[model samples]
Target: MDKVLEGLKYAAAGAGGLFAYLFGAWDALIIALVIFVVADYITGIAKAATQGKLSSAVGFKGLLKKVMIFVLVMVGTVVDKAIPAANHAIRSAVIMFYIANEGLSILENAGELGLPLPKTLKSALEKMKDEKPEDVPAEEQE
Candidate 1:
């Protein structure tokens, strides 16, 4: 009985360790961001379909851009590991950048569905979008 209990505990701990190794906080965040991005894209497409605004080409381009975001995150992970000292700074920034983008996109999705959004957040999003590319820091601008 004691041996069995120890074995079960070890197995559970090993599984948790695996999950933590594969899905660190930043990785988990990016996964959530990707889910939001996909949901937003689907809702936007559905809205377009209902409103006669469908465009396969534009949707494909948007998907490509989303793919680029993942590529950037992967690159950030590599940089993070390469540095081996900064304590996930690159990954954290990458996750934050994508989180902000996905959050804004989800807000747009909600708006398309006629859901109300906070005025301040909406205005801030507009301001962020309106800022010149050269003006915003590259990391934050993403």
Candidate 2:
């Protein structure tokens, strides 16, 4: 029992533990975000192939941006750690922001592939997508 507890403590000092701790979303958020990521990537690839502009560089950049969404999740975690009361709000907002962005990208990818998309979700995502950046004003830009 003592050995196991010590091992657990040390394991968390490494990247593998950190990755899980940081990226492991709650049950609902986990399902939704994982689905969002996979669907968005697949749709993006389809869009690229259809447009005859499939470059690995562009795809990689897109992947990096997607990865940054999770990085932002870690940002929320850090914020929560710093300010405990804001934990729930920060986590929800971060998840919502990424979900909205991913949802928008999925819609864009669909349009790029000439598929008809629902207007309402696209518009909602547009609004949600715009809100986050605007909330951080010029003074905070530094």
TM-score for each of the candidates:
0.64, 0.72
What is the model-wide C-alpha lDDT for candidate 1?
Answer: 0.70
Displacement of residue 87 (Cα, Å) in model 2 is 3.2
In model 2, which range of ten residues has the least summed lDDT? Answer: 133-142
Compared with the true structure, model 1 gives a TM-score of 0.64
Write one digit per residue (lDDT tens) for candidate 1, span 62-92. 7887777777776776778789896788777
lDDT by residue (1-142, candidate 2, tens digit) is 9999989878866766666567544457756877888899889889889889889998898788778777887788777767877845686678777777788888878887788999998888778765657776634211
Clashes of each: 0, 0
lDDT of 1 at 63: 84
